[model samples]
Target: MLTLIGGGRDRTGGRGQTAAAAIHALLREEILSLRRKPGEPIAEKDIAAAHGVSRTPVREALLRLADEGLVDIIAKSGTHVSRIPLADLPEAITIRRVLEQLAVRGAVASATGSQIIELRAILVRTAEAAEAGDTEAFHRADEAFHEAVATAGRHPGVWALVRHVKLQVDRFRRLTLPLEGRMARVVAEHEAVLAAIEARDAEAAAAAMGAHVDGLSLGLDDLKRFNPGYFLEDSARSDLKRA
Candidate 1:
């Protein structure tokens, strides 16, 4: 079931989840912005005050983030931002690339004309969002554009798989997000992918998708430098110990 991880079950849990989701959004934003810093202890009382929620909700929210592998919880030391493993980024990106290309091809093969039109409209909106420098809106449009493609494929499992691994790549993506001129390039890439889709060229669409992912892989130097040690074997072993 899609129960909130530790946000209880009924009343208390339900209320806590209301707070949990709010807290989760704020914490995720802070983490992605690097404002919270990795390995920093999660001070519950502080977060509670900042979020204006009871400690109960904050605790539940932390548990949910832990479940998502976004936070590390130690028995006595409490919780901290989960250190992202950079070395695995390429592999993670590789997996996403494969799935996305498959999704693109499937989407083209299965898409009705109306679906294609809808997707094309989203891409146009995405380009506008990027050009306007609305990062959040752009991200939303980007996500919608991809989800539409995946949906057109009629493969729900692709969404599940993409969601699972995308969290791992989120941090690096956040870092590169503000890079100057990045959005324009992304918009161009989207245009190329859209062109292929419009032409019903599955092979061309797949190639464009491959290049899109490869760009991320090639530009992830900051991710690698941000946390070299965490990418090591010992780090995985340590994380396993925590579990």
Candidate 2:
């Protein structure tokens, strides 16, 4: 029973939404941090009890995670976290590169001075978070930074696609965290990307985006080796008997 600070139910709606969001964050963090063993059955009752919530919110959160491909929902047995499929990496990386490049170029053109400052703040904080080995903080700062860039661009389509790729890429990225110095390296890459964006160098930003996603793809094999059980071959996941 681990408790996260500033975490848990938000009761404003009185619909157990805070509990749902808290449970969702916890589960996703578990998956992302490999705290929840891959292919593990994610029983709704356990989660609800853990968060002191009802079945409804717990189920709702599971459904949302399902949409993000994080969990497989079943009729009788229960929800189970999805196993990472190695073969899908190439497609995911390709999609990310295309979408993020657009995001960077568009953001560079539309960014305000304040928006660049916000992006820079996120980058610096992300570096600190990574150094501290605070995976949760690092992940939040990383996503927020990207969202900032997309928002700066005012390209809703690119933002939507970037969101899609992120959901798909997230599970695998979790697997990458244990590689020594990897998180710091990722932060450094982000610094370079943001610098390009701030300099109004659209071409550099686009190129940096390509390099960033590709570097992540390259890091996967090393990560897969470190936690071989955390990833799956599509053929091996027929039923997730083991992950």
What total of clashing residue pairs does each candidate reach? 0, 3
Each model's lDDT: 0.74, 0.75
**RMSD to the hidden true structure, all candidates:** 4.9, 4.4
The digit string of per-residue lDDT tens for model 1 on 1-243 reads: 122233222223345346667677667767765676666778888777655557887787788888777788787677888777665777889999999999999887888888888888888888787778887777778788888888888876897798788876767665576778787787888888878887889999999988987787655665457556333323363533242
Off by over 4 Å in 1: 1-37, 49-57, 222-243
Model 2 alpha-carbon miss at residue 170, Å: 0.9
TM-score of each: 0.78, 0.78
Candidate whose lDDT is highest: 2
After the best TM-score superposition of candidate 1, give how far the Cα of residue 109 lies from its true spot, in angstroms: 0.9
TM-score for candidate 1, residues paired by index: 0.78
